[model samples]
Target: MNATDRLTELFMRFPGIGPKQAKRFVYFLLREHFHFKEQLINALQELKHTGKQCERCYSFFGDKNLKNPKSKCHICLNENRDEKILMIVEKELDLDAIEKTGSYNGQYFILGGVLPPLTEKPSELIRVRELVARIYDDITNDSLEEIIFALPVTDYGDVTKEYLEKTLGQIVGMKNIKMSTLARGLSSGLELEYVDRDTFKSALERRQ
Candidate 1:
């Protein structure tokens, strides 16, 4: 177990990275200049100390947010953004994708993960309890008008959507908040994280 094997194992821990890909990452790092490796190490160290998960959306941020330990992410604090609409995405990457489109002007809530069909103990699988509380608070504030489901177009996505809609509907129904999802403009199995700007825009417009 040398540095190469140790680094490979660490890289393999990242989601979707397999043995071959992780090994390639190690070899690529070895081929790069020492300066690049140093920079990478420094960035990781800074993030380790300063990285903060948003209190509202759970999206990770760093820098100034670390200065105020109780502060929310920039998006959550932005007054110009629409408070009446909330988009629920499965992960941070998916939320990032929507932001890059530059068409959305609403709040976001990251559900953390999608659930597979017939999964047991579903609350343990994602941030279900947290989402309910968030929605309840928003509704209480009279700031929430709609909730958009921006989950991926997959089996896991469908299951998660069904579960959330039913569970959240209880609160939404009493509050009269409309719930919608991204339209079928998204191809089957398409991930919101990978959706292109134009495609996402279309889906958003066609959302029903």
Candidate 2:
């Protein structure tokens, strides 16, 4: 394939992007100044170099000019954040939306993705084992009291949430840990990443 076709194909790989939109993006780039292309390439390269995943929460954060850049992200390093409450999310975008609300001040764990119904080995699809291990470690090492499932309201999200609740509840120490999810303020079929701040705040407040 030619440069234009190859670029469009690559852009189509992004979620929600179709062939027509990807083609538009490619043509838009072609019409832009050469310096703009250079800037975009530089930014993409810098993303990989500057981004670091927090060991504890597994959230990606940029450590641009910090003294100890290898350390955890700001949220995880903050002593004021509630270590006793852990919020589980489907992806980084969901975590970002929750943070934008400024309502939740607890630790977070990104499940990476939700489980698809057709997948035979559902546990292998997401970070299930890692999440369980983290919960166990937190209960033993930290003052973990609650685990909030902050997944989307979709069917797959519900499936993953139920699976986690069942599996985690079976753990000896997890019996006392309070488990909850976002309230019905989040309409069914709406993903957490697209939830408005007011709706997110209300759902968080009414989380059961």
Candidate 3:
């Protein structure tokens, strides 16, 4: 394959990007000046060198966020964050979007991915084991009071939520930990990756 075709294929691997979009991206890049192309290459190289997955929340953080002594991201190491509540989001981007709102002051967990309905191995689709472990540790510390489902409003998101609720219910039994979700402002097919501040705040405030 030519360089353009190879680049298009790589772009197609990005989530939600298809052939047409991938080709468009490659063409756009080809049209851009050499300086812009060099900048993109340098930026990607920097990301490769600096990116680090947060051990606690599984969010993608970088060196700047590693000032803490622990092998954790800045959010996980922040003492002022609410340890009593945890918001579980579908991916790193969703978590970042929530953080950008500056509305939530609680902890977070990135589920990695969502499960489709009736999947035989739901665990393979998300970080279920890690999630359980985190909850247990929280309970042991006597700080866990609630878990909020900040997943998307789509079918896959619904399936994942049901699975988490059923699986985690056993671990949370008699623990008095409240479980909630983003409320009112969300539309039926809303995706947390693109949630607006006002909409997210309303849903968070009205979460049952």
Top model number, lDDT? 1
Span of 10 residues, lowest total lDDT, candidate 2: 184-193
User: Comparing candidate 2 with candidate 3, which one achieves the higher lDDT?
Assistant: 3
Over 4 Å off in model 2, which ranges?
65-71, 172-175, 186-190
- For residue 93, model 3's alpha carbon misses the true position, in angstroms, by 2.4
Per-residue lDDT of candidate 2, residues 26-45 (tens digit)? 99999999999999999988
lDDT of 3 by residue, 1-208 (tens): 8999999999999989999999999999999999999999998988887788778898876764435555678899899999999999998888888989899999999999999889999888899999999999999999999999998888898899999999999777769899998884546655677888898888899998
**Model 1, C-alpha of 121: deviation from truth (Å):** 0.9
Error of 1 at 100 (Å): 0.6
RMSD of each: 1.5, 2.4, 2.4
Separately for all candidates shown, the number of backbone clashes (residues 3 or more apart, or on different chains) is 0, 0, 0
- Candidate 1 lDDT (Cα, 0 to 1): 0.90
All candidates in order of TM-score, best leading: 1, 3, 2
What clash pairs does model 3 have? none
Question: Residue 94 error for model 3, in Å?
Answer: 1.8
TM-score, one value per model: 0.94, 0.87, 0.87
Q: Please, what are the lDDT tens digits per residue for candidate 1 over residues 89-129?
A: 99999989989989799999998899989999899989999
List the global CA lDDT of all models: 0.90, 0.85, 0.88
